[model samples]
Target: AFTVDVKSVANKQIPCHPEQKMLDAFLRRGEWIPNSCNQGTCGTCKVKVLSGTVAHPPTPDSVLSYQEQEEGFVLTCQSVPTSDVVIAVPAADKPSSTGHLLRDMTATVLQMQTTATDTLTISVGIDEPLEFSAGQYVELAIPGTNDVRQYSMANPPSQSNVLEFHIRRQPGGLATDAWIFDSLTAGDAINLTGPWGDFVYDDDDDETGMILLAGGTGLAPLKSIALHALTVNPQREIHLYHGVRRSADLYDVEFWESLARNYSGVRYVPCVSREHWSGRTGYVGDAMLADFDSCRNYSGYLCGPPAMVDAGVKAFKRKRMSARRIRREKYTPAP
Candidate 1:
C-alpha cells in the first residue's frame, strides 16, 4: 500500500494498493475526481505528479502525448503508484458536492420532435424521479434486443422526472436506427440506468469563462450546460459553438440567438463545415480561434466525436488553456 497526497486547499491522504489505480483509491474514499471512460481513453482524469513514480500502460496518443508523459502527467484512471505519492489534481482541489449514485428507472416517451432531417429531439417521462447534472448521461436499453446505448441529457435539473435527448439516426446503428426510424414512439416504455458522468458546470469558479464546443448530435449535453449556466450564473461569460455540416443540419439557432440577446455574457457562434453560408464557415476548431482572442482565461467543456474533441483540445492548449481547465465528455458508440 502507498500513501497518496493530493495537494490542494484541503489536502487529502488516500490509501492506495499497488495494483489499484489512483482514481479508484480516491473514489473508494468518497473523494471525487472528474473522470470519464475509466478505461483511460478520455484523458479526463489527468493529474500532474508532483512527486511520485507510477506505472501505466501506454495511453492513446490522442489522449496523452509524448511531451505530456515526459512532463510527469499521468492519467489517474490508468496509473498505479509505485510509492508514496504527491500529485496536483485541480478537480480534487476544488470544492464539489457529494456525488450521485447510479439508479435503475423506467421511462415512457413523451414526445419526439424532428429537429433536423437526421436528428430527433426526444422527451421521456421517468417512472421515478431522477436528479442529474446538466452534462450527465444515461444508458438506455433498447427493447426487443440486447443492445444498450448511452445518451446525454439535454434538459436542466429543474425537470426532475422528464428527460430530453438529441439523437441522430445512423445508417447501421442498432439502437439509433430503431429509435429514430422504426419502433420508438410516444408512450413506448424503455429501461434506463444512470444519471452518469461528471461533465457538469463547475460552481467552483464563477469568474472563469465557460466555453462549450459541440458537434453533430453532441450538441445535446452542451445545450443543457448552456441553459443551466444561464439560470445559475447570469453574469458568467459563456461561449457556445455548435458545429454541423450544412445550414439545414443546424437546429435551435433561434434559441441560442435569443439567449444571447437576453444574457449579455452569452455568445452563440455556429460553425458550418461543408457548405458556405452567411454565418461562420469552416472547421469548429478554426471558428473557435477566429471568434475568440484567447482561451487562456476560460474553462472549456467539450462534447462531440473524438476527432472534433481532439482538435478542440489542441487548439485550446495552443491558446494557453490549461489541461485542468478543459473538461471533456466524449459521445462515442456504445459497446
Candidate 2:
C-alpha cells in the first residue's frame, strides 16, 4: 500500500492503495477532486507532483504536452503512486462550497433520441428526488469496460426526478456509443453518481449579464443553465451562442429558438463552421466577437472542446474581460 500527501487548498494528507488511481482514492476517502473525462484526455484532473515517485500509464500526447510533463504535471486519473507522494491542486474557488454531492442513483431510461449523427438526447428518471445546480454533471459507469463517462445534467434542479443528458457518441466511446446507438433501451436501469462540477449558475450576480458559449455537445450544461435562468429570471438579457459544423449539427435549435421567442430578454445565435451554411457562418468565438463588441462588464460561461474553450478564454481576455468574470469547463475526448 502507498501513502499520499494530498495537498490542495485544503491541505490534507490522504493515503491510497498503490494500485488505485488518485481520483478513485480521493473519492473513496470522501475527498473531492474536480474531474471529467476520467480517461486522462481532459486536463481537468491535472495536478502538480510536489514530491515522490509515481507510475503513470501512457497518456495521449494531447492531454499533456512535453512542457507540462517536464514541469511534473500528471493526470491524476492515469497516475498511480509507487511510493508516498505529495501533490498540489488548485484551491477550490469557493472553499465553503462542497463539490458535487455524491449519491447512488438507479435511473430508468425515459426517452432516447438522436439529435445529431453522434449526439443523443437521453432522458432518465430516478426513483427518488435529486438536487443539483445548473452546469453540474454525473458519472455513468459501464459494466464491461469499467469505464466511467461524465455527462452534464441538462435538466434543471427543479425537475427533481428527471435527468437529461446531451451525450455525444465518441467513435469508440465504450459507454456512450453503446448506450446511444446500440444497446440501451427504455426501462433499462443504469447506475449514476453525481451532481459533480463546480460550474454553477450565480444567482447572486443578477446585474451582470451572462454570455454563454457552447460547442457541439458542450451545450448540455449550458442548456441546464439557460433552462434554470428562464425558470427563475426570464428577463435577464442573456446571449447564447452555439457552434456546430453543419446546419444539421445544430441540435435543439428549435428549442433554443422557442426560448428566445418566449423570453424577450434572451437572444439565441447559432454559428455554423462548415460549408452549405447560409446563416451566420463562422467560428463561435468569432460570432461572439461580432455580436458583442465589448465584454467589459459581462460574466461569461463557456463549455466545450478544449480547443474552443481555450480560444474563447483568450478572445475574452483580449477584449478586456477579467479572468475572474469568465468561467469555463473544457471537455476532453476520451482516449
Scored by lDDT, the top model is: 1
* Whole-structure CA lDDT of model 2: 0.81
Question: Root-mean-square deviation of each candidate, in angstroms?
Answer: 6.1, 3.7
Ten contiguous residues with the weakest lDDT in model 1 = 90-99
lDDT (tens digit, per residue) of candidate 1 on 243-304: 99998889888888998999999998999999999999887888888777788889898998
Stretches of candidate 1 off by over 4 Å are: 1-35, 38-95
Collision pairs in model 2:
none
C-alpha RMSD in Å of predicted model 1 compared with the true structure: 6.1
Please give the lDDT score for candidate 1.
0.82
Those runs of model 2 whose alpha carbons end farther than 4 Å from true positions after fitting are 1-22, 25-30, 34-37, 41-92, 95-98, 176-179, 202-204
Q: How many residue pairs clash in each candidate?
A: 0, 0
